[model samples]
Every structure is written in C-alpha cells, then in structure tokens.
Target: MGSVWMYAPEIGYGARQSLVGFTVEAADGVIGHVDRQQDQPGMQHLVVDTGVWKFGRSVLIPAGAVTGIDTEAQKVRVAPSREEIKAAPRFATDSETADPGYLSGVGDYYLSLRS
Candidate 1:
C-alpha cells in the first residue's frame, strides 16, 4: 500500500464549531466548523459541508489535501486555495462521492489546473 497522512481529533475543535461548517475570515480571524471526517487510521476522506463551501456541489476532500493541521483547534486547512478546491469536482451533499472514474477525472483536472 501507499503512504497516508494523519489527523488528530482527540483534542476536538471549538465549542461553537459545527461539522459541515465553513471557515470564515472575519475581523477577529479565520474560524470554521467540521462537517464530517473519515477518522479511520488507514483511510483518508473528509466531507466538507456545502453550507460553508457555498460554491461546491460536493464535500469529499482527500486527506492529503490538507496544508496544515491545527492540532490545538483540531482543524485542517487545505493547501489549495478555497477557489481551487471549490473548482474541484463537487458532489451533492445527499449523494455520496462518485466512483474512482470520477475521482480520476477530478485528479486529472486538478493536476492540469496546477500546471
């Protein structure tokens, strides 16, 4: 098998933090909520909510997508800009992520976008 990233949830997030929530930057600073997390040690998946990410149609975020992990806040900040991630393949909240074929296409498009 290949390598994978890590996530820390034992610390938990902010009290007001809501899963499927969006991280908003205000005068105070950047704050957000958690929508859902895969959590399984070997598996990698994150379901960001559409409510926070208004632009996207879906919420499946690859584990490696994270740029930094706020162990203190128990939050994950993705490396790609919000717009870049939003432009990635977005799925409906009700529907599960598409098949590998779909992921492959998304990966290809995202790779091309980075180039």
Candidate 2:
C-alpha cells in the first residue's frame, strides 16, 4: 500500500483545488465537511468538522483513505465506514497535527482497515 498521507492515484484530487467546505462522505453516509487540508506532499490530509455528529469535534482523515472526489457535487468519498472513521485515533489539533509519532499512529489505524 502507498503512504496513507498521500492520496490514492485514482482519487483525482487536483493539487490546486481546495477541499475546504466540501462535504465528506464515508462509505455508508455523510460524515462532515472539510474544515481545512494539509497538502504538504507526503503529509496530505483533511481536517473534517463533524458538526453535531461528534459534538462539533474535528477528525483528521488521511488522504489515502479517499476513494473519490466529486468537484461538481462538492464532495469527497472515503473508503472507511462511518464507524471506522469514528474509531480512528483522536486528532489533537493543538499538538498532534504536525507530530510525526501522532501521524504514524493515525496512519497505522487507517492502514489496518484495509486488512
């Protein structure tokens, strides 16, 4: 498998396009909207603001989990189910977004879903 931080080749996410505000959908249903994105080559990810769903909490979704991108509909589709995404390692925005160890743990959690 490729690095979880990089988008799958088939995801077709344009480098210049912004995903902020786009709806994020898990395999089973809508989860949230993209609050922001980290597109630093090897560390791409999306910070999704799950309003009301998780009590306004935000979650970090690695790019590799993205199954598709629909610009017209302003949506992003991910491979994991809602439950699986909810169970991912908690994202500590203040301290963990740029922490290598935290990113690795998050990557491992997503990678395990493929198996």
Candidate 3:
C-alpha cells in the first residue's frame, strides 16, 4: 500500500515499468499512441502510431520517468514535460526516476514547443 502511493496520483512514475503501447495525449486530441522509445542525449522521444497523419516524429517527452497517467482524461502528463516537454531531461529505458541535478540546467528549453 505504501509503495503504491509513491508512484501514483501524488507524483512520480508508478511501480509499473513499460512504455511500449503507453498512450500519449496532447491538447487538440489524443495525438497518437506510443510506437517506440528513443533515448537520446538530452530527451526521450516517443514514436506515435498514426495511420496517415504522420505529424509527430517521436514527440519529445520529459525524462522525469513518466509520472502519472490519467486513464479517464486519456492523458500522459510527465513532471518535467509540463514546461519543456520537448526539451525535458532524457531517460533511458532503465531510468527509474528523474534526477534533480540535471533539471535546472535544462531551463525549460522546450516550453515554446508545447502544443
């Protein structure tokens, strides 16, 4: 019970560890479903599963480790992504949590890129 509360509604990624088919919803609408993960040097991009409207080529999401997911709202909100989702810290598939030391340096670089 205690551990469950840690990565849930409150904050941070839940105990669950997997982003294969995790949905990625944006403003206008459910942008697209996560097709694949790319862990680069500064940010992690998600390849969306779009039929024909191939707009987003791996939309950049924060590396805060994908905190909580609102199943009802159908939204995948990350901590660092709020401000600079496109430039949020990058995280590898093994990343369990966001690092504080590297956050400030990012300086919300991707804030303007938000849709």
At residue 95, what lDDT does model 2 achieve?
71
Return the clash pairs for model 3, or none: none
Put down candidate 1 lDDT per residue, 17-91, tens digits, no spaces: 333444422122332344666554434556665453364344566554554555545556765565665576755
Better by lDDT, candidate 3 or 2: 2
Better of 1 and 3 by lDDT: 1
TM-score of each: 0.56, 0.95, 0.40
lDDT of 3 by residue, 1-115 (tens): 1221123335443334445576665443454566665444344534445434444333434443345565555456544432233434443333422443443333344343323
Q: Each prediction's Cα lDDT score?
A: 0.49, 0.89, 0.43
Which 10-residue span in candidate 3 carries the lowest summed lDDT?
A: 1-10
For residues 19-97, could you state the per-residue lDDT of candidate 2 as single tens digits?
Answer: 9999999878999999999998988999999899987889999999999999999999999999998999887574788
What does candidate 1 score in Cα RMSD to the true structure?
6.2
Model 3 per-residue lDDT at 92 = 38
Query: How many clashes in candidate 2?
Result: 0
How does candidate 3 fare on TM-score?
A: 0.40
The per-residue C-alpha lDDT of model 1 at residue 9 equals: 45
